[model samples]
Target: MYADPRRRPVTFFVGERVYLMMLMWKGVIWFGKRGKLAPRYIGPFSIGQLLNDQTVVLDLPAELFGIHDTFNVCYIHKCKVDDESQILSLQDLKVDMSKKLLEGPIRIVHRKVI
Candidate 1:
């Protein structure tokens, strides 16, 4: 799949793991971490469900990545810097529509091997 107009998707094998993601409505910035705690959730979802004020709707588990129901914005970070595309960086986060939305980065931290 295309990773926007600039970045390309990393090569993956059949056994490789990937998370389904899309753009988020909110802005988030991430800093390199050293502590080891909590589950490592990923993605912004490829398909997003229409949100409502009364109740919250979510993307389908099977249709989307069924592994995780929700994700934290900080899970993904840009390793390299490029000309900004109206996207929100952790350094500068704002909840606006005109700005481009993107998925959280896939990260592997020191955790017990299952």
Candidate 2:
């Protein structure tokens, strides 16, 4: 017999600050990241509004301009800002036409016969 661990779902409120999880499949391509150097999260934007129980609007800064502000709870993560220096900033990123990440291959995985 095993006891089920207590699991509590996280929730975000209006005016709260949170970071958006950087999804690799979303087509984010960092300037110098080729393999393991790529970052996993992108922002600590503030919540603009609560669209619903599962969605929140973010106040993205000028650096992340031209992108949508609304995101689901799954894409948002809690940020621990103990000090101002703890904040992170992404210098540059590249995306495809759909605004998803477009990174090149890290190495040659397969080769064909001549």
Candidate 3:
């Protein structure tokens, strides 16, 4: 009874695009280093098949061949259309050899004397 309100049904259809939750493992360089800024999910892959009501098979790329294609619905999220304004271009960013931002803020947006 307590969990009913918090629980929501999730559904997916074949050919629909969705994001898959990514798991980090020690010594797995394929997914890159895990850190505070590491990506939590990857891909907007198409649904290849439905194994059951709660399980799905994704059409993952060849690079992800090592990982199982099947995933539980809990680990999948529907992909929404991309927002143009929300996208950032890498060319606009200025980084040094170490990949740290080389430029500071152009102007302070707020300042307090207190």
TM-scores of all candidate predictions against the true structure: 0.18, 0.62, 0.67
Task: State the RMSD for candidate 1.
Answer: 17.2
Top lDDT hit: 3
Relative to the true structure, candidate 3 reaches a TM of 0.67
Compose the digit string of candidate 1's lDDT tens values, residues 1-114: 655678654432222223433333233322322235212433322324323322223343463443344333223332232433433334333324664444464455568968
**Better model by lDDT, 1 or 2?**
2
Provide the overall lDDT of each model, using Cα atoms, as 2-decimal numbers.
0.35, 0.74, 0.76
lDDT tens digits, residue span 5-113, model 3: 8777888899988888766776553443258756676777889999999999999889778778999998998888565344333345676778677777655779999
lDDT of 2 by residue, 58-101 (tens): 99877667568899999988887857565645543466678577
Two-way lDDT contest, 1 vs 3, winner? 3
Can you tell me which runs of candidate 1 are displaced by over 4 Å? 1-41, 60-114
- Give lDDT: candidate 1, residue 97: 65
Name the runs in model 2 displaced over 4 angstroms: 1-5, 26-34, 91-114
Off by over 4 Å in 3: 4-7, 27-30, 82-96, 101-114
lDDT of 3 at 99: 62
In the predicted model 1, the residue pairs found to clash are 21-45, 21-46, 22-44, 22-45, 29-90, 76-104, 76-105
